[model samples]
Target chain A: MSTLEITDLHVSVNTEDGPKPILNGVTLTIKDGETHAIMGPNGSGKSTLAYSIAGHPKYTVTGGTVTLDGEDVLAMSVDERARAGLFLAMQYPVEVPGVSVSNFLRTAKTAIDGESPKLRTWVKDVNNALQALDLDPTFASRSVNEGFSGGEKKRHEIAQLELLDPKVAVLDETDSGLDIDALKIVSEGVNRFASKGNKGVLLITHYTRVLRYIKPDFVHVFVAGRIAEQGGAELADQLEAEGYDKYTSALR
Target chain B: MTVTDVARESVASALEQAPVVSHLNPLPSYDLADHPVPTGREEVWRFTPIKRLRGILDGEPSDARLEWDTSVPEGIEISTITAEQARELGELPPNERPAALAVARSGGAALIDVPAELAPGEPLVIRLTGASVDDLVWGHLVFRIGNHADVTIVLLHSGSARYCATTSFLVGDGARVNVVSLQDWADDAVHLGRDAIRVGRDASVKHTSVSFGGDVVRMHANVEYAAPGGEAELLGLYFADAGQHLEHRLFADHNQPRTKSNVAYKGALQGQGAHTVWIGNVLIRKVAEGIETYEENRNLVLTDGCQADSVPNLEIETGEIAGAGHASATARLDDEQLFYLRSRGVSDVEARRLVLHGFFNDLIRKVGVPSLEGRLTQTVEVELAKTVLAGVPLGASLILPVEEVAD
Candidate 1:
């Protein structure tokens, strides 16, 4: 089974003031078939952890070690990280003009799998994935995420997660802008992916609503770039009853 | 009778209903001796680097050797006629000095005439290959399409030479014509040409210019309607590499009522000293009521040290026109798009290649010539390799399947 390990990850981003630290000495570990929920308020460095693990050039890893199944994850390029079984469903999916969704999906699959997929079966798979997400078949011909609504963008991300089938999927705030119907559809897609056994999922969100659908195995409260508390699934229910004020006030 | 012939008969009868305007003036002519040499001060010649004209504007003609090969379809006639013969065939007067000089020094014009009501099944192709001679060369060509005829003309230019040519089209009533001019000259070649088209009543003309080669290439394409209910579509595609200057200027004058014009041009620039200029002008005269016009120009800059200048101008003296609009844009590669592609396991180099191909795909499809479309796609690929993809390592898998490798 694949294991993603992060040790004392110190991440910083360049801002107008200077290189401001976002993630300070944060540590987390997730193994295959485990769903880890990271619940944090705004400005708690939750998304920074996801971007850093995905090897985004914008986030600098000053003092940290990230390993995927004992392989150096921090040293890989963004595309290499993706090929090495890491996937990121960005909070705001970028609009890629001129690249059809079908082409993008096939290219990513080919690149990650190291071979071109069988056309007949691949087309069927893509259609099925899009159908599961409630996206029309014609959506495959349009430019990726270009002119798509907020809910459509999230649905497309889930569709990608299903098609790519990465070892570890880091979804950052995927439920923020989605409506109730879209939220349920997206959660169902994620559930289907997680049901495929031996897949790791790191769901970063500020609400416990998505947890009700996906049913995380573990919950961690993040505050000020560090994990303040950790528990089993019951902690999520407690946080929903209360709020992040206790955690933020304790950090202050 | 053919449908176009029937339409022409009806349009001829309806032409009497078009209003005559006394205020619509003709374009300024430089054929007279009093028209002073452009010091880069005139509005029309302001953007042109006059010093690089190689004395073509000073009445000095080059003795360069140019080889001509043409494939004429059946029922079409081609002949070499003197300038006087061409003028007698309704060739309009030159509006600029370069065209005037070409007409004055060419001594003769290559004329292609299509008879009335006869449509050729194949395109009329002409290949003009220039030798490495430094002397300036002047050429004049005329295409005459008779009433209700449909034709396609492909003008291909290649090799190296300092050349200037003036091409004129006389389209008859209700005729449909598509003229594609491709400038694929070798490096160090300088070219200046003017194409003037006169569209007849109820007729439509599609004029396209594709520029990819040469050190300095400039073309002026102007259109004027001979009668009402005419239509013109001006399309251009260009790629400018290092140390090259490519300029395309277009003007569509709507002097008749119920006329329409659409102009779209797209270009890409890369490397140092690469420059491209697009100037689109549309004038709707007071008498040209119910006219519709739209002009758009877009440029993609692939690298630093390159400049793309796009100017779209619409001068309308009539408020009764259906629609009139113009747009221009020049942009570099989108960083977000690059990141999105890269995040999907596409390498940096492959991502860029895809973006560049997509930038030119829409315009290339609009060209509407199957054979020409394939060649342009290959040309764009080669251009990308030469400039932007020069140093990047293109992965072996990106080009070929793993099974194809010998190892």
Candidate 2:
């Protein structure tokens, strides 16, 4: 079983002032077939944790240990972490100019699988993945994330998640900016992946509306660079009824 | 106020409100005396590294000739004629020093004549290959397209030489023409060339200049309408390696009413001392009302110590024009785009190559030569191999693995 364990991670981002610490003494774990949703308000260092796990050059890990299936994730480069089965669906995926989505997916698939995918099967898989996300089969020909609407960008990410099939996926605010119908479509796509029962998902969002569709096994109250509290799925309902005011007010 | 209201009081008052013409483009002349050798201080020659030109501006006489290979159809003619015959046959005169030298020293012009109503799906290919880098060659060519004709011309230059040439296109009424000039010269070759076109009434012309392999390549493409309703599109693409200097100058003169012109050029520079320049100018005279013109230049500096100078100048005399605009930009490889691609499991090498290919893919598609597209793509890949793929020491990840051959 694939397991991702982050132990007491301390991260800082370099700013005009200095190294501004964003994540402090944060620890979490997601085991096989488990979906953990980390609910936090703005400035909670949730997205920072996601990018750090994926080894973005913008963030520095002062003290931490991230292991994926007993392999040192922190020691690997960005692409190596990806090959080692770590995926980060970005909050704002940047637009890649003139690189068609079809070509991009194929390149990614080749890099992940260490060889070219079978053309006939690969094309069919791409069309099927995009179709399941309500994206047109023609969408495969477009440039990656270029000129995509808000819902389309998120759905395109989900399509990539399905096609890439990483061991652990860190979805950073995938539900934000999505309409109700698009949210349902994206949630169903996630549920289909979760149902496979071989992958681990760490869903980071500010809303409990998505948890209603894809049930999370656990919910952690994240605030101000650390986890304020932790509980089972019921904690999501409590946070929906009562926002993170208590935690932020305590920090204040 | 009768016609007497327009009477001149001295010559200065009558000329006070006249449209201003650019000094960058000197008046065209058949006499070589009118075109002077520049000292690198002239506005048109300021960006050019004059020393690297290797005395091409000196206009010395040379007897060398480039080997010419042509594919002329049955209805077309390829023959040699005197410069006097060329000018008598309505060829645009040279407007610059290098071009004037080319016409003055080339001895004669190669005339390619296409008959009226001759529409060929196949391109007319002219391949000129030089023998040595020490060879000093001058060339003059006049392509005459008759009324209502449609033609695509491909001019290919290769090998090594210090070559200066002038070419003219006399397009007749209602004709359509596409001319692609590919400068794939040797690394030591220096070329100074100019293309001047006179578009007849209702005619359309598309001229594309692509320079990939040259040490010092300076080219100019000038267009002026012979009558109203004519249109011109000037497109250019170039790549400059270390110590290479590539320059392109474009001039669109709207001498007739209701005309249109569009100019776009894209270039990429890699390695130290790699420099590129794009100068685009459009002059709309007072008579040229209701015209539309736009010019854009984009440069991608792929490495350190590379310079790209892009200048777009528009001299519009009439405010009644439909549109007039220009854009110029030069940028380095984007880090965010690289990270985005690498986050998808793409290796550093592949990610960089993909980003660059994406940068040029849109402009390459606009070349409109389907047969040459694959070749151009391959050439771009080869150019990338000299820098990014050759292991410029961008970490250990930039180098390709054993199994990662060309995909």
Candidate 3:
């Protein structure tokens, strides 16, 4: 079992003007088998928290402590964090023009596992994962996210999540651009991953619709670079009805 | 004035009023005296570092010998013929000094002839290995493809010597030919070569040049149609490492109506002093109506301190052509690509390697030689390894100062 603990995490990003603080004293803890949903309005630091945990170069951790089962996650490099069983489903998945999906997946797997996977079973596993996400087996030969649709991109992330099987997944707005059918497909994929019973899910989203499919054990209402309130899944429903107005006004 | 006289006068005036726009000068002569030695000021020799040419432009001759081998399939003829005998087949006029010198010095030429209506089962292979020599070596070669014949020729160069050569092709009516000329010389070798091809009626020719080694290698390939319904495709691939100079210049003269030409060249440069030059010129003459032509060049800079020069020129004497266009681009690795790969757990080095491979993959596939594909891929991998180590570190560090990020 793995536990992710983020305490007093202060992150800032450099802009044209100067260093701008994005996440101000945000703290959260997620243990194995728990799903925590972070909902917020635009520019409320939800994605910042996700990128910070994944060690994106753009976000500087000014003052924070992030640990994975007592291991110092903040001290690790981006790839090291990934090898330590942390994954980030980016909001905007990048397009790599010439690298095929199969090659990228295999290379990532090899890097994470510290050895090359057996080719015979690996190909089968990749095909099965792609099929599970409603992606064509031929998609493996296509360049990584080069010309994929929004729904396809989200589904590919879920497929990767299932195949990589990280201990913790910080999904940043994976359901934002998905339609109803795509939302269901992606939610089911995430739910299947959660059902594994040994992973932690930190789902970042702006709407409560995805929460309807993949129930969150904990819901945090984020405002002004910090979590203003936290409660059980009922809090998501309350925010759904009331919206972020209450939190934003209270912060003001 | 009479009606006929008035009509003729108007037509003559209209023809006189039309502006004459020349895209390229007329083809130079093969006689050494007809062309003056270049002082590097001429447009054709401006990009070349002429001083390093070791006086070859001044008609310098070397006593060095090159080891030659040919592997031909049955029914194909190969023989060595004196320069006098070669002239009987056809007159191959040189357009530049190196070509003129090569023709003047080469006592004999290696001739490869394919019979009419015969399709070769396999590609004919020619291997020319240069011994380590300081003297300048000159060579001349001729390829004659018979009517309706189809063949592929592979010319491989290796080892070390200062060399200059000219290769000519005579494509018969309705014939199809593909020629791959690879320049993989030693680090100290300097090579200058010219390829002149004459495409006959309804014939198709594809010429590909691949350059990887040599301190200084410059190749000029020109194509002209002997009759209408001819086609030519010129493709080039080059990689220049530190202190190496590799240049490829191409000209396609559309002198016959209904002919077609296409030119594409791609290159990669890395390390300090690594330079590459690509010049593509296409001229559509007034009589060459209903012709189509396009040229494109792209370069990838793997590190700082390397230069890539690409020039595409199109000169149309008449506005009646079907289509004419050209494009060129030189760029470094995309930062977003590197970030995307790194975010997926690929190390910086591995990510760069993948990007370089992808950049060259499409061009390499166009060669279509199955036997050489694997070796070329491995060669690129090895080249990347050597240059990747000495270049600017791949993928910027995450830690950024206030000043650094602001800019």
**Model 2 residue A168 lDDT score:** 95
Model 1 misplaced regions, further than 4 Å: A42-44, A206-208, A222-224, A238-252, B1-27, B30-35, B62-65, B81-92, B115-121, B146-149, B172-175, B319-322, B392-407
lDDT of 3 by residue, B1-407 (tens): 99998997676456445432233543566578866888788888889998887777777656666898888977789889887776677644777788888888887888888898889879999999998747678999988889999999999998888889989888999999999999999998889999889898999999999999998999989888889999999999999999999999998988789999999898999878999999998878777899999999999887778899998988776678889999999988776666666666766677777777877776788788888889888888878878663445533422222223334
- Candidate with top DockQ is 2
- Estimate how well candidate 1 is docked, as a DockQ score: 0.25
Model 2 chain B is weakest, by summed lDDT over 10 consecutive residues, at B398-407
The candidate that wins on lDDT is 2
The sequence of per-residue lDDT tens digits that candidate 2 reaches over residues A94-203 is 89887899999999999999999999999999999999999999998888898999999999999999999999999999999999999999999999988888799999
* Candidate 1 residue pairs that clash: B62-B136
Error of 3 at A51 (Å): 3.1
Q: Is candidate 1 or candidate 2 better by TM-score?
A: 2
Q: Candidate 1 chain A: minimum summed lDDT over ten consecutive residues — where?
A: A55-64
Sorted into a CAPRI-style docking class, model 1 comes out as acceptable
**Residue B202, candidate 3: C-alpha displacement in angstroms:** 4.7
